[model samples]
Target: NTDVTDQRSAEEQSRYLMGELNHRTKNLLAVVQAIARNTARSTMPEAFLDTFAARLGGLAASNDLLVAQDWSSVHLEDLVMGQLRTIGADEDVRVVVGGAPFLVCPQHAQVIGMALHELATNSLKHGALAHPEGRLRIVWTGASSANWKLEWDESLPSALVPPERKGFGHVVMVDMVERALDGVVKLEFRSSGVLWSLNVRGPGVGR
Candidate 1:
């Protein structure tokens, strides 16, 4: 009788895990589909595969942190450092990250993670990371129990010509962030480089 009871409990746990796996699998696939669609739309046919792969890699990096933390939440510092580490800039003196850490929900984590990745990738490809005299600074502060803010500033040696159009990364930063955090996003490509900030208010900042 005891053996039978143990078997039943084991089966129940297995079923629960199976259900969780299914749910996460579906969620990941949905994100990938969205990424694919958007990447295809924004990239030239010849450049699509590489672009999609890099974006997917960014998503995977976020997922890795989530998985390590049992999918409940991710620390803001971890998210920022993980993304920067991908491009070998984590140890660069020119790149400075100073901020108050926050526990971000999975939904916000995904968007912010990708946004950070895109930002770092851009720097590596075209911004300060590409030049010796450039500097990049990232700072975040909690305004109160109900709000927080993040500021990203990149300084290049010379003025950057703003893109003529908004591309996939640009859209991801402004649109995805606003939707995820119930926040206001201000992004601009100033003469020096890029300046982007987000101020998130209400209970959503912590949640």
Candidate 2:
């Protein structure tokens, strides 16, 4: 009778672990699906492939950070830098990031990381980072215990005009990322450059 009880307990533990694995697998698949759909906007096959690959790399980096922290929370600075590094933003001397220390919940890190990836890619391709003299400044502000705001401001060359068409980058920032964080996003295109602002509420704040 003792042996049977021990065997049953082991089996139950195995079943529970398997169930948890399945759940996490399903969630991962869902996230990948969303990324695929969002990254399918490029008309050229090569462009699509490149963009998709970079986005996936960003997601992987975010996951790595979350895992390192036991999936509880990650520092906002680490999350930003990880995404930037994955997208090669570290190579640019003109890009700047400054903010008070804060924590990002695991639930929002992936989305926010992806959003930063998209922004950096856009800047490298068409925004400030595309030109030799253009510059980018990213700053965040808020009390540690309340909501926070982050801004991505770019300064371009004198003669550029705003894009007439909305691209995947725009959608990711204004729609997908904003919705995911349950926050608000504002993007403005001025002659100086593009300025993007994100306001995330306290509920989205990590412990």
Candidate 3:
């Protein structure tokens, strides 16, 4: 009788552990599903779900990269390039990146990654990357106040201003910059191109 009771207790413990794991897994899936739903609902129904999924996946990839580095900051240049590749943009896609290596906190890195992804997706859909003759220039510099400024300028020949209706991508970009990073975003519509400026502050340079 004693042996049977011990075996039952062990089995119960194993079952309890498995149940707890399953519950946690379900909760995680629920969170991901909520994200997908929110993304879809925020944009027009015609917006591509695949694109939304891809952006979320990009965030996951960035998270993994940061994890590999033990949650330390990442180089701005490398992080930008990695996010670009996540969305299937080739290095030869008229995309120019220039900046001295600078470190950004993990939280900053994630926000920057999302912002970059949003901008790249917009370019691919309607801004610069839509046309073969178009070009994108990304530049970054550090300010004396320990702030950082990154700019995205695109020269799309004959390109028109973005539509009056702001999409989910735009909303996400603005919110991430303002709320997440406490940064400012300036968007300009020019006859020759579109220019975006992002100003952010973090730990001092070389920290």
Could you tell me every candidate's TM-score relative to the true structure?
0.94, 0.85, 0.76
- Sorted by TM-score, highest first, which candidate order results? 1, 2, 3
- Pairs that collide, model 3: none
Q: Write the per-residue lDDT of candidate 3 for residues 123-169, one digit (tens) a residue.
A: 88777888888989999987445678889998988956766877666
Candidates 1 and 2 compared: the better one by TM-score is 1
Q: What C-alpha lDDT do the candidate models reach, one value each?
A: 0.88, 0.82, 0.75
Question: Model 1 TM-score?
Answer: 0.94
Candidate 1 has its poorest 10 consecutive residues by lDDT at 198-207
For 1-207, candidate 1 gives per-residue lDDT tens digits of: 999999999999999999998999999999999999999999899999988998888898899999999888778889988888878888999988987657888888999988998899988888889999999999998745666888889999998878888998998898989987879999989989998898887757554
Q: Report the C-alpha displacement of residue 143, candidate 3, in angstroms.
A: 6.1
Best of the candidates, lDDT: 1
User: What's the distance in Å from true for residue 44, model 2?
Assistant: 2.7
Write the candidate numbers in order of decreasing lDDT.
1, 2, 3
Encode model 2's per-residue lDDT on 3-106: one tens digit a residue. 99999999999999889768867987898887788668543666777777888898899999988987788988898888778857775698888898888888
Identify the runs in model 2 with alpha carbons over 4 angstroms from their true place. 1-18
TM for candidate 3 is 0.76
Off by over 4 Å in 3: 1-34, 44-48, 143-145, 201-207
- Residue pairs whose backbone atoms clash in candidate 2: none
